[model samples]
Target: MTATLDHTAAPLIRRPAGRPLRQLVVPYLYVLPAALFVAAFLLYPMVLTAWRSLTHFDGISDPTFAGLDNFRDLFADPHFLLSLRNTVIWTVAAVIFPVTLGLVFALAFSRVRWGGFFKTVIYLPATISAAAAGILFSFVFNYDNGILNMILRGIGLSGLASRWLFDVPTNTFAMIATYTWQQTGLNMMLFLVGLQGLPPEPIEAAKIEGCTGWNLVRRIILPMLMPYVVITTLLAIVNGFKVFDLIWVMTQGGPGRASETLAVTMYREGFILFKQGYSAAIAVVISVVALAFSYFYLRSVLEQEARQ
Candidate 1:
């Protein structure tokens, strides 16, 4: 009887020696490849860019230490200042128009018949590449003959139609409008998702308390959709800061660089003029600005969450 008890206890006590070690290390083993990839690709490039920004490297020549000269020159250049101004305009317009229009469209679609079809139609532009949309709008805004001009002439509003991409503020606003058309659809879909996922109790209760129409939306629905609003608005701001493909394809930051944003300026300096170090400085500045925006957004979100 003692031997039988000892044998049973031995079976329970003698676990596989390697089992716990394998369990501890397996997850890290699985994650190692991705970590290595990020270090090699993402982290290494970022470090290299930062170092290069402090040196004078024109791609072909040996890099020489320049210590803030590139940044100093950047601030002094009128074109760079203009680029900064244009970037600000892009960020503001992108946020206001896309987010607002998206919310409006989402609300309208939620109420209307054939809403799904209308949504599909509106979302069609988002399926098109930014470059393609840029090219399409370039023709639409052509000086001599474009659909927009033709329609304006037909409606006796031809005076309002001018050189859309040639003027300073008009060119900037034209690009903003094009961006809005492309972006609003995605925002609408996101808001619609938020609306559909909302719990019925608050809305039902609001209705029971005689809340209706704009008041209901303003007080109850909008507050509930805060998460989606944060996401969409942040995305719009980031995209605006990074806008390059559309500007490149449409205006090529043309008419003497009047419409150049920082991204465009960076590309023209680095690739076109071969000012590698200056371009790196511009890239670093852009990254810092984008991070600042993200940080503020995250802070605001956390504050809201805490308050709730």
Candidate 2:
């Protein structure tokens, strides 16, 4: 009996020795493919762009070192400044509208029957390619023979129908509205997921304590869903900054650069004007801005999660 007990004990001791190795190896294997993809796609392009930003290539001749001249020119360019302002406006409006409407939709859907069907319909836009959506909105917002103008004329609001893409304020708002329509559904889905995951015990307790209506949402639901809100808002901001296809298809940054975003500017400079170095500089700036925003956003999320 003593010999048999010793043999079993030996295997148990050996099992513990292999556990730590298996744990470490399994996680590393799972992450290996993702790490390779990031290195190949994201990191490589970033490094190459930074290098190109310092040179004058124009995609034909050998690149010559230009130091910081490209950046200097970018800062002084009036068109670039306009693009920057447009980008900021786009980011702010995009984040605000999508997140706000998403929260509203999430709340409504969470409490209603047949909500899944409505949710699917709302999320449908997110499945459409941005280029296709842009083309669709182009017809909708066309100044002459457009659906919007036709509807306005029918409703006796013909006076309000004007060249939307030509006017700065209206054009900007029009583009932002299109983006909001597509993005709100995604935000709604995120919030819905967050809402569903919330602890029911607290919600029931709050209801029992007469925490009804706005109080229930404001104090109970919103707090629990803060993490989701932050994630979706950051995503909206990034997408807004990177907006190109819609603006490209609808306005072509046209009627006179009214709708030109950084991405559009980059495309025009690099591909259209063949100013590859200058375009690379703009691309570098965009990448930097995106990275900075992501870092801060992630940090805030981490801190919030820790506190919770």
Candidate 3:
């Protein structure tokens, strides 16, 4: 009887290994459609863009190999440099302002009565089309008849009035403000979700230990929400770098090129100026940057999760 049992167990043990392979294959089969879609839309375009970057493609003619000439031209263009600077400025300001404001709002809302209502209100902007938001804000920021300037004048702050879309500094600020307003709710939502998922014991314990108000938030809540913070920060950084529509619709890369981002630069190169190859190079650069950021962001999130 023991010998028969052992013989049966051997087959069962061996069968488990084969089952794992079948399980793995089934999951892959399920994912195959998504994988193919990504390959077709994302991977193929990326490879093609990299190839196009090495050529002089004007979209109409056969592409001629340009070697590194496009890159050389990109480096030499002062407008490109200015665009780069403006992009960096936009990214930094957008990330800082929205994320900071989001954190504050998240913390406040978490502790407040009727917080869900406010959260919904704040997040409403995120649902609006960026192009439409840009158009709306453009009217608000208009020099003569804009609501913002009108409010400023009414408040006896007329000196603050300027051509918001035409001036470099003001244009950048207006764009950043618009971006912040749109994104803050998303960030707040992320934090709110994180807050909701937190274990209640630690919070209750902290309160019993005399942790209240800001102390409770700073010492207990903030530390617990680190994962959400990292996620929101990464998202903000990526979005900031990719911002184009609002800037494009609001300023069209500006009176000069004041609010132009890398995305806008790519668009102007590819579509407006008809430098397809150059635009491809710019697109590649932006893709590479985004990939690097996402890789690190995901890695950090995973590591933090493992530690927790």
Q: Which model scores highest in lDDT?
A: 1
Clashing pairs in 1: none
- Per residue, candidate 1 scores C-alpha lDDT tens digits across 182-284 of 9989999989988988889999999999999999999999999888798788878988998999999988897899999999999999999999999999999
TM-score of each: 0.90, 0.86, 0.88
User: Which candidate model has the greater TM-score, 2 or 3?
Assistant: 3
Question: Each candidate: what lDDT?
Answer: 0.91, 0.88, 0.87
User: Residue 182 of model 3: what lDDT?
Assistant: 90
How many residue pairs clash in all the candidates, one count each? Answer: 0, 0, 0
**For candidate 3, lDDT tens digit of each residue in 190-294?**
888888889999999999999999899889988988888887888788888888899899999977775687899999989998999999988887898888888
What lDDT score is found at residue 23 in candidate 2? 82
Across residues 1-308, which tens digit of lDDT does each residue of candidate 2 receive? 99999998987777444567788799999999999999999999888889999999789999999999999999899999999999999999988898899989989988789988999888899899888888888788898988999999999999999877778778888888888888888899888988888989989999999999999999998888888888788877888888999889888897688679899999999999999999999999898888887887788678766866
Sort the predicted structures by TM-score, highest score first.
Answer: 1, 3, 2
- Candidate 3 collision pairs: none
How many Å off is the CA of 149 in candidate 2?
A: 0.7
Candidate order, lDDT descending? 1, 2, 3
